[model samples]
Target: METAVIKTPIGYAEFKGDEQGLAAVKVLDTATVTVIPTVLQEAANQVLAYFEGSRTTFDLKLNPQGTAFQKKVWQALLKIPYGTTTSYLELSKTLGDVKAIRAVAAANGKNPLWIVVPCHRVIGSNGELTGYAGGLSRKKWLLDHESPVKQGKLF
Candidate 1:
């Protein structure tokens, strides 16, 4: 696996992958100083575009490592609209097992693709921000960034 780190408004983002496909994307306290492979550079560019609000969707090949159930949960996450939020309970219901809320949350937490997979879009059942591996503040930033009601300028 090859790794490259790029700076973002939130923090440094590390992308891991090779010629095959992108495997992981994680926010880090510090940036990595290494030559970025072509594939990784493309991923880095996409991430930067996302933060800039110019890109609303990602189209890179992903290879996140996880169990079948976890992959299923992450795949469902991708279907969530860019500006919408869903609760763990909603996710479980979407998966055809409302009783599996906890398991669904666990799988959501383990998603390796970060913004690409969009696990941060999931909230608590009461519409509260919950656990986010990248920190709640970043999650808030991401949600706000994707808010459809953009602020209009006053003349």
Candidate 2:
């Protein structure tokens, strides 16, 4: 798989994929060399646009690797609109099994694609920010970034 690391406001983000589609997008602890490939440049650009608040939705080919159930959960995550949040219980209900809340949350936590899959949009039933592979601060930042209330322009 081809990989590229690009700088973002929160931190560096690494994108991995090939001609078929993007397999993963991860946030790194530190900045790395920007070696973006031609095939993945569009994905990189879309991520940049997201951070800039110029693009609310992504239009890139995705090929996230996961189990069948995980894939189903991830696909449901895509339905979450920008600037809105959903609880694990709500997500579970949407999946047709409120009893599977834990399983749905597990799949969400295991999502391989980061911002693209929008796992950050999932929250606790009490409206609290929950576990995030990228850290709570990053998750909060993502939510605030997408918030309709404009505190100020994010450059």
Candidate 3:
């Protein structure tokens, strides 16, 4: 799989994938740019556009590697609208199993596509930010980035 890194307002985005499609898109504290392969360039551009506030949805050929259950949870995450949020219980109900809240949270954490898959949209039952593989600060940044109200813009 080809790999590349690009800077973003929040951090450096590390992309990994090939002809099969993007397998992972992780954020790193620091990294330098590398030549993005032909296959990964379009996705990279779309990601940059998203961070720039020009794009709200992604349309890449995704090939995230995960279990069937995990994939199902990710599909639900995709359905979450750009500026909306959902809770684990709500997601579990959506998946047809309120009892699977823990399991659903597990699958949400394992989402490898980061912003491309939007695991950050999930929150605690009480409307609080919760566990995020990328950390809560980044999650807040993402949520704020998607917020439609633009009373402030900090660059």
RMSD of 2: 2.3
Which digits, one per residue and each the tens of the lDDT, describe model 1 over residues 1-155? 99998888888888999888999999987776567788798898888899988999999999989999999999999999999999999999999999999999999999999899999999998999999999999999999899999778898
The TM-score measured for candidate 3 stands at 0.96
Clashing residue pairs in all predictions, respectively, total: 0, 0, 0
lDDT of 3 at 45: 99
- The alpha-carbon RMSD values of the candidates against the true structure, listed in the order shown, are 1.8, 2.3, 1.9
TM-score against truth, every candidate? 0.94, 0.96, 0.96
Pairs of residues clashing in candidate 3: none
lDDT of each: 0.92, 0.95, 0.95
Off by over 4 Å in 3: 153-155
Quote model 1's TM-score: 0.94
> Of the candidates numbered 1 and 2, which has the greater lDDT value?
2
State the weakest 10-residue window (summed lDDT) of model 3. Answer: 146-155
